[model samples]
Target: MPQRRRNNRVAVSGATGFIGRALSNFLESNGYEVIRLKRQHFKSKKSQLRTLLKGCSVVINLAGAPIAARKWTPNYKKEILNSRINTTGVLVDAIKEMEPKPELFISASAVGIYDSYEVHDEFSTSYATDFLGTVCQAWEAEACKVQRIKDVRLCIVRLGVVLGNEGGAFPKMLRPFKLGLGAKLGDGHQVFPYIHLNDVLNAFWYIIQHETSSGIYNLVAPQMLSNLEITEAIKQRTKKSILPVIPEKILRMLLGEGANALLIGQKVVPDRLEKDGFTFEFPTIEAVLDDLIC
Candidate 1:
């Protein structure tokens, strides 16, 4: 892929995270100076944030605890919430202090902001009350506050499940199928919205470079498949059979509320991303699985 021009100096929070690392590397390789903002030990939050963001042309916020971490205990839940909220809060506060603010603010969000087990697009209004949905809602809400600062453009990307060979939801899923233990979860009717990692990176770059882009955009592929359909597709592509579906009740008993969030499904499509002229490299699950597995 050809790189974009290095016109913007970017500051990124959560630069060490999965998507963050990928985005930072892409930006740097493309000739942008990227600075990572880390939590300070002795320095106050404001001071450290201000120092890191000074003179930056853009700020990309991808900081958040992984939602898939096991057993969402009270402490873990608090950590999940604070990690995202505090990171955005810090960045927003810092931008407010900077004399000349960054032109673009790109923040991360998840498709979970919509109702679980239902189809949603950028225009979808149905939102779930589940923990994941609430987290995404709060995360995007905090990031939106950046718009209040004059001359700042805010873009919130509501991401779907990201598929990549390196690090993401794919390897863990492949483990079960590779071991022949993989089976469809729940009723297998829930829609699973997903996107290729490369597409995600491209979308970010496009939004950052296009001055007209702003507001909430769905970062997902055109194809939306059910849990069973995805399993079958993987099975066909990998030449493996996944029978004997995993019962939803059993998953609930084992994984609790988190299991419901995972096992249940949502059919989401990127109506806005496509309409805005962004293209997907892998639109179908079969294509995605073929590329990643092979």
Candidate 2:
């Protein structure tokens, strides 16, 4: 059985970002008392952070700088890595001190941990060593520390590209296609691992509701998609012509190491979530374009 209504408080870091705002709204609408954890909270002393978390039933860490926001300069790459690991490290400390620790801690990660062009599930052991991969590895490593706290379950969600019209890469992605200028990226073979934004929110809710739902989960749609298929779908849906293919060499020059993120993708699936009976709201690219583009 779940706890009393008074104990239904939840603290969420990164409560200002795209996914965070959506989740905060969802939880509040469902009667959850949400305490938004901010960057300033992580900067304070560990005990100070704990006071903010008092009486909370859950703590979700989605606090991090945008991945593809800027070119991955050596200094900027450091910023990306520290943003995730540092916020997560502080949360781990604060959670360690909670007398009645939150029932669960779900930290945000990414599918970039797996090598590009390979199929992966929660059980895949073949990890990548690139900048994005190492960042996720370190980010999850910090969250893993919470497993040491007795009775508090730890869940790390490896997110793919979350598709929504309002925010994330989806809106920017649509602009080019809408103008009839969309093109195949790289060799047009990289997988486009993605999921609907609503499903991302529900996946978090599902974990909180299911007591036995613990450990890592790939919060991606089950269908494996490639760049060509996605491009063709967008073209057909919008009744637009395909633009000239953008050479990977040009992309690499423009984005630096960040191009790897755009040109390579993991074939990830939400295996654990499906086995646990979670249903996806949007599972196919066509369904996604239909709901989003129309």
Candidate 3:
């Protein structure tokens, strides 16, 4: 493998978010200068955004409103789309105007873009028509605009559920299982694609370091598990008895449209990532659970 340039500058939007915070720390610790771009910067003026991004070798855009943060009301849904698309649009436009453009442009997408049933890889064309799927599609579309710029390697990472000790769904998941109320969500048939926090950071760093690494890549573990499979894994790890399954109707009633996130999921695999030789620190749900639990 080629050695990364010492002091290679990288500008990252959404640096305060869960993945962004971790990524920024990882880059800095590895001798890369990371500039955190705020939403306010994009809202200010293009010149300011350009000035902030200028001279950086890599640009990572992860700006998006939290989908699971609140009820998916009409206004909140609009906020989610606008946050991702608008921020990405600003970055893409700024990249176009940059003198010496960043070598690599990496943006975020979600596996929710794929339909619920069957396995999906980078090559699969089937996409969901729901709210999240539409959001992911539009987010990627804005990111694809960077391709028009000459010599810029564009990589769109379709993220799976990110599991980590801090900040992600992992912390919330621990609450139920810890209380011995661990149970499958919905029918437990929907395949959930997930990745460890370590792998997520490594994938971003891997793409930036390897000049040839570009295009859409699924940032997920090779082992795709159904909800029942994951629940069982948690049960084994915690040594706790499983409770009754939570019905989809209950989740829907509580979360509204956001329940689709838990009820419907894609069986996404990181084929390109593995083919590219990126190793996972936590390859299986068992491994992930053990690391985080016992």
Candidate 4:
């Protein structure tokens, strides 16, 4: 591991969200000064953002709506896009104005950017045309604009499902299994790319400390799981009775278009992260669930 940069000032947007909270705490614990950039901070002119971002060595952009929070109404979809794209655009503009800008800009994307059935990696161009995909594409485009600046290095991380005991999909996912209502969804064949929360935090640290790292990375574990495989692992830990498979139609009826984000899946590989030498602490579904489920 590279030596920690204790004196560096780091700025983070979405500092209150699941990933953001973890990242902020990690940075602080490592002796890095963290500046939490709230949504209100970006409301005024680009100058306001530039002032807020000044003197920071690194900036992490993780602001976005929870994709599975609600049914995809047209308005809600707009909220999703605007929240990510607009904020990213403002940040990029601000970075352009900074005299001595942050050295690195780490932004968020999702594996949903890829087409559902295909195997994808950082090099794959097979992208989805759905609402989620469109949102990620635009979000990334705004972040990539920072690349035009010669000094600032930009990294876009396309995250998979992040599992942890404290929050995120793990807690809600564990509920059904704990209630003895555990079952697979939609024949459970869809590939489920996942990474432990620890690895998520570490990936950010790895990128920040390693100045050579940039561009798109799939922040997922080495061993990808099928939905059924993950469900089975959860069941083993919970010792829950295996319930009937939940049909996709029922999920759609219940969750509306939001169900597509859950039911439809992607096989995303962390080709860049692995090739670049970032090792996962929990690399498999069994390892990830074992740590969180117990």
Top-lDDT candidate index? 3
* Residue pairs with clashing backbones, model 1: none
Clashing pairs in 4: none
How displaced is residue 32 in candidate 2, in Å?
A: 0.7
> Could you tell me how far off, in angstroms, the CA of residue 230 lies in candidate 3 after the best superposition?
0.4
TM-score winner: 3
Clashes of each: 0, 0, 0, 0
lDDT of 3 by residue, 1-294 (tens): 776653499999999999999999999999888999987898897898888887998899999998787788899899999999999999999999998888889999999999987688899989999999999999999999999999888999999999998797988887888899889998898887889999899988789888788899999999988989998988888888888798888888888999988888798889998988888988998888878885
Output the TM-score of candidate 2: 0.96
Better of 1 and 2 by TM-score: 2
Q: Which regions of candidate 3 deviate over 4 angstroms?
A: 3-7
- Put down candidate 4 lDDT per residue, 1-294, tens digits, no spaces: 566543499999999999999999998998888999998887876777787788998989999888988778888888889999999988888888887888889999999999987789899989999888888998999999999998899999999999888778888889989999878999898888889999999999899998788899999999978899988888988888888798999888877888888888898899998888778899988888778876
Whole-model lDDT, candidate 1? 0.82
What C-alpha lDDT, on a 0 to 100 scale, does residue 82 get in candidate 2?
93
Q: List per-prediction Cα lDDT, in the order shown.
A: 0.82, 0.89, 0.90, 0.88
Better of 2 and 4 by lDDT: 2
What would the TM-scores of all predictions be? 0.93, 0.96, 0.97, 0.96
Q: What's the lDDT of the predicted structure labeled candidate 3?
A: 0.90
